[model samples]
Target: MQDTTQSDPNQQASTTPITGGEPRYKNILVIEDEHFIGELYMRALTKAGYNVKIIIDGPSGLKEAQTNAYDIILLDLMIPNMTGMELLKKLRDPNSTPNLKSKIIITTNLEQADEAKDEIEKQADGYIVKAEVTPKQLVRFLQSLER
Candidate 1:
């Protein structure tokens, strides 16, 4: 595995909903190996005024997630270099990685058994089936998370 993280130069500042007539910034990290999906998410999220970045593989995703800069992390289960579940475990482990501030959400089309799904849900802040959410809807979903 290599450190293949590519942080875009267009990375915007964090954004926040109006509170006290002031703007706050929020950073979102999307970990999806699929290029099209990742770009779709990036466009939607960036349009919504979030500082969004996309990492296309598990190792880079994991490295970026550990930085504690992102307010939200949208992760895919199937990724190159490593599995999302494995990355999630590391992120959640207090000994291995502690005080992570990002809200980790699992976004994948992979179907799992009830037991497996439950287990993933237990480890992640939220889970969404990719097939069920359009790019616009994903932004809306993220808005709900902010509230």
Candidate 2:
């Protein structure tokens, strides 16, 4: 399988100001199983002036994503209880959770075929390989969504 672990150019061109005189905190939800990775993302996003919440499993994460409003969602593919793909489908369905308008970004370690990646990209706003980007870079990517 090809390693499609590169940042989107459009995302790289984002010039949104994450911090300024007053803190403009954008709410973010992170659905990751690994404690270390989730904490890393929380720290980086919090430092970048974003309100971040993390859920370790898919079921609770899906509930949180549905009940609350968030600017962005960082999702892991291979999560417990419910998979990220299942959550994505539910989140995308207007009838399932009508108020969920958060931009979903897949942040996973799983490798997939090119066709599968394309399908996932169509479903999600963005995709990132966990090993490919630093926390700081992830922040930049999230900032890009503001534009």
Candidate 3:
């Protein structure tokens, strides 16, 4: 059997199947300001047997992400209190916050210029436009991440 718990600070998740066909990443954190979208993700992900938590603002999301060890973080760009880019900078900066093991995936409806988009993609594990994807599609994406 593979070891699920990570000893390395840089790698993301406790990625090993426990029993049956359960996914490696069981816990997920969603940072989104839109109530409907957050709820939709929570509902779909929970139903799929993954634990999910949703934060409405970037500050709270950053704080929670810093303090806890979530397997994945679904971040929105246009959020209250702070921007996702700012949060990404802080989270990815080893000098500011070290030993962050969560996989941060950018989930947003906002469009970015070529250079900006390249930068965002560089910092994050994955990027998905919220307006283009559904809750079920997001769940599938998460599952694919485990592979």
Candidate 4:
């Protein structure tokens, strides 16, 4: 990535209740390769009062991220043509269009935390393991995104 960090890694995160108080984010962009997971996330996030858009492939994800104005971006590690890291790199580059300021997060199944550890050094707002996150937990996860 192009080094877009503005905060330290150990920053504290706060969570809000799920009983419909007020949403911290309105627009969310989910970039994943699996339609099943994308569909699930779409349903969950839309129910959470987010205007969610899903892109099922990496190239499409990149294109969508470039064109759509979003408040948050969810990325999956594995995708066709371009990996999540490459997509992030493209987003962080100054030469790209859209000039994204939407907070970014990665939801993936990759085990190589050391190899993936470099991402935390980048500007991702959050990271979650897909297998470990439940639907309800995902809702809470979105809540914590306000942090």
TM per prediction: 0.81, 0.83, 0.84, 0.81
Give the TM-score (vs. native) of candidate 4. Answer: 0.81
Model 2, stretches more than 4 Å misplaced? 1-25
Candidate 2 has which clashing residue pairs, if any? none
Mind giving the per-residue lDDT tens digits that candidate 4 earns over 19-64?
A: 4655668898898878889999989878878888888777888788
lDDT tens digits, residues 45-118, model 2? 89888899999898899889888999888999989999888888888889987998788999888797898798
Candidate 4 positional error at 137, Å: 1.2
Better of 1 and 3 by lDDT: 3
Model 4 accuracy (lDDT, Cα) = 0.78
Comparison by lDDT, 2 against 3, better one: 3
List candidate 1 segments past 4 Å from native: 1-25
- Sort the candidates on TM-score, descending order: 3, 2, 4, 1
lDDT of 4 at 113: 65
Model 3 lDDT per residue over 66-109, tens place? 78889998888888999989998887888766878888899888
- TM-score attained by model 2: 0.83
Residue 138 error, candidate 4, Å:
1.6
Winning model by lDDT:
3
**lDDT by residue for model 1 (62-91), tens:** 788776578888999999999988888888
Error of 1 at 26 (Å): 1.5
The alpha-carbon lDDT assigned to residue 145 of candidate 2 equals 63
The lDDT per prediction is: 0.82, 0.84, 0.86, 0.78
Give the root-mean-square deviation of each candidate in angstroms.
10.4, 9.8, 5.5, 8.3
